[model samples]
Target: MQIKHQVVTRTPLGGFTLVEVLASVALISIVAAYFVHIQIQQVQERVVEALAQDVLTLANASMTYFSQTNEWPDQENGDCDDLIATLGGLGAFPVAVGGYQGPDGITLATRCEDTGDLGRTLLISVNFPFGADDQAQMLMSYLPTSVNEDVDDDEGPVVTHYVATPRRASERYRFYRIALEERGIFRLSKPDCPGRRNDPAHILLPQAICMPASAQGLGGYFFDEIDDDDDYWELQLLVADGEENNNVSDFMEFSGIPTCDGNRVYVGAITYCETR
Candidate 1:
């Protein structure tokens, strides 16, 4: 057997090419970026949802306080800090109820007043801090139409800085009183109104215009304009009814005022009401 020298072809151990390494790195970076984007979006959604729920919860708490104490949690000029103080400081109100200190990048504007029709009215407006345009828009989506419609139509981006008070009975009374004081008229032309018609009875006019004989000031009367609509005035009477039992005919009686359609009353002009 001739011992033939077997030439062992020694192939050098191969390493990854620069292009392949770069491609792998690029793929990993893309996957990481995608996951990060998803996480960011989820975080944002959770933040806004929590914010919306907190706002509703605070409003409800304020209403409950008003219902029980015939007063609001904070004063007319109260802001978020004032609310925190009014609610017995942190770990109270929102914190106690929802485990939330309040929405980030937002402020609170609250007013409590004695609306003649609605016993004790509370107005809570959520305001976005300056330079929080994104947060404002996000909040607008969650806000009710009552607040969203207030956004200026001839605006750049509908800078919805203010959110109207909820349409609950306690809140609507505040809004109704504010409209009368500022606009000298309270017209529920929004679809939420029962008839959506500008009836003199439904269309609350200043006492001067409708009831010249009644007290000159915007007193505890719902309608001054007298018309053939007995039904409308009847509804107003329910509001003016002092007897607690007669005030709310139905549990859903809106602000103790009767409505033809029983829809949520919307008064667009009244942004807020100051305490008396």
Candidate 2:
């Protein structure tokens, strides 16, 4: 009788191999990263959209308040905090708009009180945030046609007018001007004339001079080089108490200049107020 001993080999069945475990971890990490990226993008888009909407709401409220009360919300030295406080006090600011909290560092650069202009001009500025490079473009799209028009004329040359004429200023659109640190300053200004220079209703003229770049990143061409017939005009706020036909050139010029020390840029807007 030959006793045959069968050898029993037991294979370990409880755990995965090193390669398999690593591959599974990589797959899960990729999936999680992709979904997380998607969520982040969605949130950013919502924030941009919400900001645009909120700014528009604020602009409209300002216009309405001026229309009803015949004056802008008063502020101290055109300070943005003071502007916000004044509006909030008057219940003019929006209550629940997401991402519309008052900016932390914005300050009002100029106001009607400063310029003594009949038309209310509010120049507010803050440090350009890390993620808000697209805000200018976004806000441009929502601007009213009165502010966002292509007034190019084909009569021998393209003519662009910036800063709505006094006639057009009544259309309820806010005009915007942006100054960047790296790119210097650029504005929307009236074209050099023999075009529409002396239009009786236009406040900006053909010969209006733009300020030169100074120690402050303040001076540049009023017209961006890209567009020949741009619609933005160099805005000059004029003050004439009880005088409706005041000359636009006689008033002090409100230079759209930014401060040199900070990483901030100036973003300003003009809205017409019914003073008469």
By TM-score, the best candidate is 1
- Total clashing pairs for each candidate: 0, 13
Predicted candidate 2 versus true structure: per-residue lDDT over 207-255, tens digit per residue:
2233344453422223223333344443323222222334433333233
Candidate 1 total steric clashes = 0
lDDT of 1 at 98: 36
Q: After superposition, how far is residue 29 of candidate 2 from its true place, in Å?
A: 1.7
Clashing pairs in 1: none
Where model 2 places Cα greater than 4 Å from the true spot, the runs are: 1-15, 69-71, 75-82, 94-276
Listed in order, each prediction's TM-score against the native is 0.40, 0.37
The worst-scoring run of ten residues by lDDT in candidate 2 lies at: 155-164
lDDT over C-alpha atoms for residue 273 of model 2? 23
Provide the lDDT at 246 for model 1: 31
Superposed by TM-score, candidate 1 places the C-alpha of residue 79 at a distance from the truth, in angstroms, of 12
What is the C-alpha lDDT profile of model 1 across 102-150, one tens digit per residue? 5454555555544443343455556554455565567768866425324
